[model samples]
Target: MQIDFTPDPRLYPFQSRWFDGSRGRLHYLDEGDGPPILLCHGNPTWSFLYRDIIVALRDRFRCIAPDYLGFGLSERPAGFGYKIDEHAQVVGEFVDHLGLDGYLTMGQDWGGPISMAVAVERAERVRGVVLGNTWFWPADTFSTKAFSRVMSSPPMQYAVLHRNFFVERLIPAGTRDRPSAAVMEHYRAVQPSAEARKGVAEMPKQILAAHPLLARLAREVPAKLGAKPALFVWGMKDFAFRPGPTLPRMRTAFPDHVVVELPDAKHFIQEDAPDRISAAIIERFG
Candidate 1:
């Protein structure tokens, strides 16, 4: 199935606008005024990843899910740096520009670290956190042979962005059950222009498990989170962060939090088990 690059009117009905003088034109869905529930997505996915969740929760809580600058409807500037710090800064500006204070957050995959950075910097603005198929620590959960091979190969970068090999091969292989054709198509459609693909391509090359920044962030997050109401929803079948390592770390870090593992689901828990996950979020936050 081929992805559609043209914006979907149904998915994005609101008028998209630029924030912080065209750093990017952010795509956001704002509805039913109240304290915001910010939803952050991971790599290769965008605000579209939260469509079902947004539909499920918008009536009860104000939903604010933005496509990170390089991901979805947001502008993907050519030759831009897509480091963790850069992403965190953009998220901070995105939230602050709207004057969102004391809002809850839902994060998955890369969203986990990015949102934590936001919460750490703007603790006063965060009321709660929900983690889905994500991790904070640089544990040995993802040192698979395939992953290691890609990490070691310089050619992997070219395969990922230029050829879409990462999405075409790695992502599907990581899941126990293949994503629906529609969902896969949507994921493929969001890639930015060729010039903008530099950041997208370079992401895998930048991953270094022993990086000091990851360690520092991991150490700081647990202390910062404290006993704030948190929800950990996991997909046991996830290949990247399997139950053995990921769940234990979460349990160790957040002993008091609620943790649910859907044995049949995969890494993209929201896509594979949307109804169940959405219900869990509603029960916890509603």
Candidate 2:
């Protein structure tokens, strides 16, 4: 698939990097030169999601944000499944290829599972973790299941494929503050065609189809990386991944974790509270 989108330099003024992993070529941002912080993104978003955090923290931390294959400026290779497990696999290869001896992991949305999967494998090298509105267990809640089913249904899938529903509708609804027209267009331009939106469309289905992987992470993450310091920057008002249940479940895995509650922010905490989130990261993992 050909993506004709170039990031606005004023908004995303960083050098772009690429990694040719086992899966495909991935576009990433590697800025600053201190302790590395790997930023993993979620559905319908890309490295672009972390632009603010990277700008704020890059002065003191080596901020690395990668666009997973089939998203952002990454290549959408033919025949790729675009499954959660596949994303984890590709990210794992990216980590190994980078030879990162020690780094911090930060993830939100699907990023939580995918980044943690990498951390679990490289537990010795992972010094800490930062998580936001996301999950790594079998998503069996009524709301989760209902959302997955409805979004994966034919009509919703069609809307996502043709109309860019996630970027147009969910991205706005997920954040307390609406994104600017430029920000929305940056997202829309990347996945302008049905072929480019394949990864975005596959994720809703993966919520159910990837349960076994989630189940594995539920066990393995706590067992292996529970000792690592954890920070939960939660968006309390998030429609999905509500703090009431989700935060406690995460605490069960990281009993010694620190929590930074964002009462007004929603699912896309990166968008709504990047400055606060950056401050918390510097305090906890600086």
Each candidate's number of clashing pairs is: 1, 0
- Candidate 1 RMSD computed on C-alpha atoms after optimal superposition onto the true structure: 3.3
* Model 1 spans > 4 angstroms off: 1-4, 9-17, 139-152, 174-177
Query: On a 0 to 1 TM-score scale, where does candidate 2 land against the true structure?
Result: 0.99
lDDT of 1 by residue, 13-95 (tens): 44444464245555566655666898888766777777777777777888888777677766676545777667777888888
lDDT of each: 0.71, 0.92
Give one digit per residue, the lDDT tens place, for model 2 in 91-142.
Answer: 9999888888779999999999999888898999998989999999998799
State TM-scores per candidate: 0.88, 0.99
Clashing pairs in 1: 102-125
